[model samples]
Target: MDLRSRIEASYKRIAQEAYDKGYADSIKDIMDLRFGGMPDESLAALREIKDVAVMRSIQNAALSWDRDEVLTLIAQSRSA
Candidate 1:
């Protein structure tokens, strides 16, 4: 599949897993961490079903970042 299709499919799978694992709150927390308080679009997206594939895709996307850098960005964004 193409990238977009893969992402959608991943999203669906991740969403389901999130629901099953009772990690809905965790997803919200991640969004808050990344977006500095969560945009409406992100919130709306999180409200959609949690699927493992999507969650993995998101995790993969973030894998390139250094953990410290990610934390720094989150901190800087929050302070902005």
Candidate 2:
């Protein structure tokens, strides 16, 4: 690829990573507040999700759902 294309790809990757981290952290924070902490399996499942849109949706759901429900959704997403 050309230098400009390479730079654009790199920037997009970095931006996506930032968004992932933010969404993951938000979910974790919600889990912590509701349940005191999150399960390791659930955290691992969250890490396995590479899609920013899925992560954002999970974060939004975590705000209201119980820990078990959130974990189940995360696991289902990973399997799908």
Candidate 3:
């Protein structure tokens, strides 16, 4: 690929990795607060979320409540 195309591809990859890390961290926080370890379904659902802000919101929500409620909020956001 051309230099410009390579640069754009690299930027996209970096951004995607950062988002993935944020999502993983949020999932870990939720798991710790609820199940004390990662749960497959929750992890899968979190992977489906691409917005960092929404993932952060779910992490915040987990601080106050259980996993189901947090998942419900995420699902609602996805549908909207």
How many clashes in each candidate?
Answer: 16, 0, 0
lDDT per residue for candidate 2 within 1-80, as digits (tens), equals 99999999999999988878778888888888877888888888897788877877777677776566788779888899
Worst 10 residues of 2 by lDDT: 60-69
Q: Report the alpha-carbon TM-score of model 1 versus the true structure.
A: 0.38
Q: List TM-score per model, in order.
A: 0.38, 0.83, 0.62
Per-residue CA lDDT of model 3 for 50-78, tens digit only, reads 77778777877787766676778667766
Candidate 2's TM-score reads: 0.83
- Give the TM-score comparing model 3 with the true structure, all chains together: 0.62
Against the reference, the lDDT scores of all candidates come to: 0.51, 0.82, 0.74
